[model samples]
Target: MRRRNLTLAALAAGGTLAMLPGAAAWSAEGSYPDKPLRLIVGFAPGGGADALTRIIAEGLSKQLGQQVIVENRPGADGVLAAQATSSAKPDGYTLLMGTNTAMVAAPTLRPTPPYDPFKAFTPISSAGQFSMFLVVPASLPAKSVNELLAMVAAKPGAYNSASSNSASELAMLQLLGERKVVNARYKGDMQAMTDLLGGQIHMMFTTGTLAPGFVKEGRIRALATLLPQRSALLPDVPTGGELGLGKLTITPWAGFFGPPGLPQAITDKLSQELQNTLKRPDVHAQLVQQGFEGYGMSPVKFAEFFRAQYEAFGATVRQHNVKFE
Candidate 1:
């Protein structure tokens, strides 16, 4: 009886030992990025999203001690990248640099979007936020939001605002409808800016990264920003909210996301690395120079913030009756 008990005990002990390595392998959270990670940006190269992703990718590569490559898959107003990232394995190898337009506004704009915004992906962290500015050709006379409103009100449908068919355009349209201003629409902000410069379009609501350089060079005049407060880069410009157009507070934001069901260990590690990357002084300064505010948030906080933005954008879309083809 004693010999039989000893053999059974040995077998149980061996089984437990065999299970230990598998458990440790599953729970081994450190050195999170054991392989190359892909950071997907849903815009073409040389755009704001690409630029920011490149910066973050470099920093993340260093932090993870692995190659973090930025892959651009621009199409369908950022929907292609969203769908691809959403369907990818949730192993931390593939990550999406979530944007306001693709993740939040697209669902409301399209009758049937490719994926559900909230369920298709898990939030990592918000990298930054930036306010869109209402800018015109430097030669235009209107200087403030009120003045511009009056001008547009006086000549309804005479002025035009440009955007890239996402939240930017929808927000601007909602603001116009609220103020009862009629205007023309273009395919994208760049085209609108081209027309504005060529004396075809009158005005456009554009992102700071694209507007500041033109504003600085006297190519475009920044009339007002769509943020609650003035931008540090363009300190002289006032916010539309401050001018009693609080409804125009549309701040473009960017965040990190991965496929749903990512292990909490991998998610936590990625979030920590992202927060550290954003904390670098050079990164902060570069983002500020581009008229963006560094908006690093914890994963939980970012999820809440993203949800709020999604809901807000949806409301704006509904209010404006926006539809995309």
Candidate 2:
């Protein structure tokens, strides 16, 4: 009888031990994000990417019952922020507001390739897309895309154009196509826009979210946009296609990503909340005004989409014969 009792107790203890991992996992998942979370952005504060990210962060904060702070780690066309996120603890506390520039363009453009998009991070959900606007200083003599090209043709390297990310750089390259224009690289759009406003640079590919207000205020001149249709927010601005500069078009997108090895439960929780946040009527309205289209997808769907985009960007780079300098 004593032996049987001891055997029963040992079995019970073993059972509890067997359940601990699962129970601990459940507890972790259930009480997740007890503290504030950090959402990294690769752009300076007050720029289009930063502004749009803040909006989503606010929505996420409300949904998760914690602060979702936007921490800017701007540099290397968003690669710095992405690298930080990829190397962070896989606790779901640190996330990246990744852009096409970081995920597709910057890496593809670089000679060494910082990190593999497939292995560096786990895709959470897509944030949205932006319209690229060809903007110049209001004081610039050129009034249209054609005039800008003519100016570049007439005076080889007299004008310097700024680019903060690969999408912008590629668009400018395609537009100029062997025309000698000095390339001024910036860590973020706001800094580049500042230079343009100060006459440090003559022109740049600014985003729709950042351009409309400045253009309306006559602070900058918008020559064209890379949108399929004229942005409703900037209805007066024509698209690159309309200007017969269709090759200048490029699609810029943003999304959320977690450090690799993030727990599945945490991933699902964040993804569902993000999708909800994007669907909010208030959120949708504000995003539209900022020249963004809110988008969301499940982890699996976004992963597939990310892979497809990576390949497409590679093809674009090869086709353009773009070389890293």
Instruction: Give all TM-scores, in the order shown.
Output: 0.85, 0.70
Scored by CA lDDT, what does every candidate get?
Answer: 0.79, 0.86
What is the C-alpha lDDT profile of model 1 across 1-325, one tens digit per residue?
Answer: 9999999999898768757745533554654668899989999998777887888888878878999999999988788999899999988999999888788767667777778888999999999776578887877788766677788888866676666657667667756765554456666667777888887767777877678788888888888877667887688888776677666545688999999998777888889889998888877777776667765788899999898887777777667776666
Tell me the deviation in Å of residue 213 in model 2. Answer: 3.8
Candidate 1 residue 47 C-alpha distance from true site, Å: 2.6
User: What clash pairs does model 2 have?
Assistant: none
List candidate 2 segments past 4 Å from native: 1-34, 44-47, 75-77, 135-162, 174-204, 214-224, 228-230, 238-249, 285-291
**Worst lDDT window (10 residues) for model 1?**
22-31
lDDT of 2 by residue, 233-255 (tens): 77888988888875653567789
- In model 1, state the lDDT of residue 91: 87
